[model samples]
Target: MKEEFQNYIDYHKNKGGTGKLFKFELVEYKPGFLKLKGFFNSETLNPVGTVQGGQINSMLDDVTSLLLIYESKGTIYPNSTNLHSIHHRPLFEGEVIVTAEIIKKGKTIATIRGEAFSKDGKLAATLIHTALIMKSE
Candidate 1:
């Protein structure tokens, strides 16, 4: 299952969309947990030279969904219901680590916590995402 998930991400990385655009690399993957590493250049920076909030939110959303997919073993996928993020600091021109962990998984709903850390190990942003787990027919 883990291999399948990795392959899924790998396929998407080359295909297109946010995965390809952001160049997210899967650093770790396990049941109920996933971590991704990505780097952004000046193009991703805001006018003030800090990473844009939308970029951080996208990373959190992607990682959280991946973790849910892993936890469900591909039988279920998440549809984000709510997302709340708190920005702790600004990030500029360095590697970013995005991590997601499933806090609770129920029959049709799940709660996931995501965090984005700067290269220097400071918490850049934190997110709590709630999603509906839709079972594949």
Candidate 2:
């Protein structure tokens, strides 16, 4: 299922540098929950020997958005609400695992909670995001 989804996204969605350049693996997925792991290279690192927060946040956002897109079939999608991210620690240049779960889903919006961990399973960051489901005419 994930391979098919990734193939579809890769062929259909015009993902920018992060999506194309980085290596992301689908760790797990179910009816309303999804987990992904993103590998971070030197290009994703900050000056302090740690991966940039933006990169981690972006990975969480991307995975959560993917979950939303997979759920909402026939609709235009947008991030209509803010994503609140909390950085717990720094993830160095290595393998980072992130997981997202759908907390709630509404007609026009959905809420997802996600978390990121370092290679050693250390908590790195967390995020709560609101995704907007759109209708296209």
Candidate 3:
């Protein structure tokens, strides 16, 4: 990324009050993207002995909101307007990685796209999210 864009991301990341989530330290933030890497433990598996859909959805939604908030510069997002997820295959207990990117950042709303990959580097799920800012400058 260009220096200007980097600065922009940093500026918003700082003044935007996005610090609390840093405690998780599970996700990595790029210029306009976020990546979360982790392996689902056995406890995360559902009765079917695979990662639960709700668990994956929760993580993806959180990352999407976090990224959109950063793109908003400093606005606080109240909630996501629409969230869509597609599970292509089962995610057995193993290492999983997720990458999400902002597709559009409007004045009051932002959209993001992400995908989860298993240890084999195959797509496990695809996510689309839209967030609506609660407060504005």
Candidate 4:
């Protein structure tokens, strides 16, 4: 885990927010790419008995945004413009590993791709996320 992101996670870990709910932990990282592990439990399940699509999307959005923020050294703040997601299989309550990488980054926009895998290493969902870049002062 990188120092900056580790600090961010530590700072938010006990804040009673969604980070705590999802239990996101950095697994691996490099420039322009990273992998995260998340725990999904009964709280994340929909009535159909699988993790809800919205929860998965939230994970995708958070991971992608974190990557962009990190790659920019916190200079490129981004507001999500769109998130295109595909559900390959239903994810149940358990550990999920998500990987995100910068697809393309430009002055005014960025594109990121992310994939979520179940504990068994099966691809469960994927996302293509776009955001409008905002430079920090």
lDDT of 2: 0.77
The superposed Cα distance between candidate 2 and the true structure at residue 97, in angstroms, equals 1.0
- What Cα-based lDDT does every candidate model obtain? 0.82, 0.77, 0.69, 0.86
In model 3, where do residues sit more than 4 Å from their true spots? 1-28, 71-74
lDDT (10s digit) by residue, model 1, range 42-64: 77789999999988888788889
Q: Estimate each model's TM-score.
A: 0.87, 0.87, 0.71, 0.90
Q: What tens-digit string does per-residue lDDT give for candidate 3 at 2-103? A: 453345445544664332222123446777787766556676789989999977776677667656655556457637888899999988876678778989
Q: Which regions of candidate 2 fall more than 4 Å away from where they truly are?
A: 12-14, 73-76
Rank candidates by lDDT, best first.
4, 1, 2, 3
- The worst-scoring run of ten residues by lDDT in candidate 2 lies at 7-16
lDDT of 4: 0.86
Clashes in predicted model 3: 0
lDDT for each residue of candidate 2 in 28-126, tens digit (9 for 90 to 100): 888888787678889888888788889888888877777777666525564648889999988888778888888998888888988998889988899
lDDT of 2 at 22: 53
Mark the regions of model 4 whose C-alpha exceeds 4 Å error after superposition: 11-16
lDDT of 4 at 125: 95
lDDT of 4 at 53: 96
Task: Tell me, by TM-score, which candidate is best.
Answer: 4
TM-score, predicted candidate 4 vs. hidden true structure: 0.90
Write model 4 residue lDDT over 20-78, tens digit each, in one string: 77788889988889898988889999998999999999888888887887777777777
